[model samples]
Target: MITLYGSPLSGNTHKVRMALAFLGLPWDERLTDAAARQSDAFAALTPMRQIPLFVDGGLTLRDSQAILAYLAARYRPGDWDGHTPEERSAIALWLSHAANEIANGPAALRLARRFGLAIPEDHAAAVTARFLPVIEAHLERRDWLAGDRLTIADLAASPYLALMEDAGIDPADWPAIHGWTRRIAALPAFPAIPGWPGEGAN
Candidate 1:
């Protein structure tokens, strides 16, 4: 059985859950959070103690992007995994962007706004201002993030990007980015990011 350890409301965790849904794989989820990570049991599982941890049989994985890549390549094969060398590199680039830019930009802002996290609001705003347009401009030339079809890259990036409003930014300001997220939402197997823009997307 595949077991995912993370909080459902967490965008990082939610992305992994979305990948599992799209793969049409039935799995169990263990609710984990910041406090839960402090437990000795959790620490024994992963020294990193990060949420969005995936356990399939004996293999234990941390980080949402890594988990998504493993799921795509392992279970579904060519369905979501990149087909070409260039496509794989492109997907890797977006995965890095998700871990750095998207995580620090909108995701940090949402944490600060909703949970009063100590992140500097101004810095996060600057990051978002810089990050959103690049995606908008890039999507103007392509339908998906990597290759000609949907891949784990889109799944890795879209959750936090969809939460622009939660970070005090307007989705209307970036039509291409907005449309891209809506397209993900329209996917038959896409799971909604609860309370975010993708929640009731058509």
Candidate 2:
């Protein structure tokens, strides 16, 4: 069976869970705590000691974006992944955005606010101010972030954006982005993450 090591509160971990659900993959989740992550057993599995590690058969993967691509390519075939090279590149762009801007922006704000992380308030505010409008404008033009269909880009970026409320941001402030999230939550197999705003989404 595929094994997933993650925390329920982690948006990175939720990204993998949502991808697995979307791809119809079954996994045995091993929830990990901070102490467990530092344990020798966990360290042996992943030196980075990050949550949301994936192990299936002989393949081991880290990083939520990489894991999302792997799960889509291996299990979803032409469905969740992009088809043409340009389409794939477009998706890759958003995946990088997920790892960088989304992570540093909304996700970081959530982390700082809820978990008491050391991220600078001004920096998080600046990131939110800069990136949220970009996302809104992008969504204003297209329903999905990349390609004609939903791809890894949508899954990669949605988790953090869904938690915008937790970051002290209002979905009402960005209607297009908020509506786009409702569209994602409307997907047949979308998984719910704790403290995210998917409840009652259309």
lDDT string for model 1 (1-202, tens) is 9999988778999889888898889889898878999999999998988888999899999999999889888876765877778878899999999999999999999999877889888998899889888999999988899888889999999888877777777888888888888888888887766665653552
- TM-scores for all candidates: the values are 0.93, 0.93
Regions of candidate 2 where Cα sits further than 4 Å from its true position: 199-202
Error of 2 at 10 (Å): 1.0
User: lDDT tens digits, residues 1-202, model 2?
Assistant: 9999999888899889988887788999998988999999999998899978999989999999999888888877666777878888888888988988888888889888888888877887887799888889999999998877788898889888888888888888998888888888878888777655564752
- Compute the lDDT for candidate 1: 0.86
Which residue pairs collide in model 2, if any? none
Global Cα RMSD, each model: 1.7, 1.6
User: Which pairs in model 1 have colliding backbones?
Assistant: none
